[model samples]
Target: MRRREFLKGCASLSACSLLFPSFVFAYSGQPLKRYKRAHLVWEDGRPVKAKEIKPEEEYLFFYPFRATPCLLVNTQQKLKGAKLRLEDGKEYIWKGGIGPGRSIVAFVAICTHQLSYPTRERTLISYHPPGKKSSLLERDRVIQCCAHMSAFDPAKGGKVIEGPAKDPLPAVILSEENGKIYAEAVLGRDLFEEFFDVYRRELRKEYGSSKKAKEEVNRCVTTPLRKYTKEVIRC
Candidate 1:
């Protein structure tokens, strides 16, 4: 099936968590994107307290406009010694959520493989560490999607530990202000087709059962090619 059709079917089946990462930019040596977002409050109308997040368990949350699902896992210890490789051959240490013993890190919850969403529903596969007969060590403390068996390390800037995804899960940078954690920026590509696909769905609603109408609705942004490779990936 065509890629678009496959994605549509996945959406219908709620199989949005298959890790089909098409963020494939020839990143042999290049720079990824940098970003900062406005104040994003919790959908539940309360600050996520550090005390509530148990060790090695995940806390799921949504963002502005409910555009995407973000996965937060607290390791009870600060995430340390993880490598963050930028597209531009730069590397850095990411202590996601400050220091050890209160380390809570968030990642783009959409599976990079197919831009699929992982859930606690039937798709839920309990976390299994390495050395298990069927374990995929890409490491522990991960956000896993059973759909395509894609896994990502939430503590390590969403790096693909093991899966078909070529790129890391786009890091949703978080910051603490006035004693509350807020997503400050996205330090990589946009969630696959988030707004663009929304427009496509809206167009379908506007022009039901009309192929010509669907064809007539032009997309504002096609998948764009990078203009410059030397741009800096902000931390």
Candidate 2:
């Protein structure tokens, strides 16, 4: 009876280990600092008069309409809004919020899973591969990547929930000057590129050499061996 009980306990533990393998190598979430807006177009490819926008209205920019960059002014008092883009020489529609009063939220238009751009369909876009759903609605509440069905909370700065996404979508910053709102920056900080450098050092201390032990041995032995052979031939 004692042996049977021990075997059952081991089986249960093994099952639990297989069920939660994700916890073994979870990704960390660290906050990046917010940055000011830069590189925005207003009228005729000119800098936006940021302070000119009013609280109750949302300004829109349409790219490549005729002469490349066109400004579409919509002062709708509702929360829903639309903007068109031609970034990377491709056409994409961005659907999000006009907010209650001068509030703005922005997210990357690409699907995090496969980079398939989702088109707006009454605030929701559905994916075909495995059939998933995501959306952007009313004041940047959430930007959903439909390919993997990952929902990101923009107010919380693009944190991910549900689906297969392990990283948040890159965020765009906004600023106002002369009552007009303009995009400031993407992901707030340029330091995001250095994330891997910080993580690799931490991993080395905790998990040992990320480089193979065999590779390190091969490098050290080959260099000394070649030098010793040269010395012997000279003698």
Tell me each candidate's RMSD, in Å, in order.
16.9, 23.9
lDDT of 2: 0.33
How well does model 1 score by local distance difference test? 0.48
* Model 1 per-residue lDDT at 136: 47
In model 1, which regions exceed 4 Å deviation?
Answer: 1-44, 86-95, 99-102, 119-139, 194-235
What are the Cα lDDT values of the candidates? 0.48, 0.33
Tens digit of lDDT per residue, candidate 2, span 37-107?
A: 23344335445443433333322221111101111121223433232222233222223323343235444
Kindly list the per-residue Cα lDDT of model 1 for residues 69-185, writing each as its tens digit. Answer: 555566555565366664444664444563244376666666666665533222333233232223444445666666667666666677666767655676655555566565644
Q: Which parts of model 2 are misplaced by more than 4 Å? A: 1-102, 119-140, 188-235
Candidate maximizing lDDT: 1
The numbered model that scores best in TM-score is 1
Clashes of 1: 17
At residue 229, what lDDT does model 1 achieve? 17
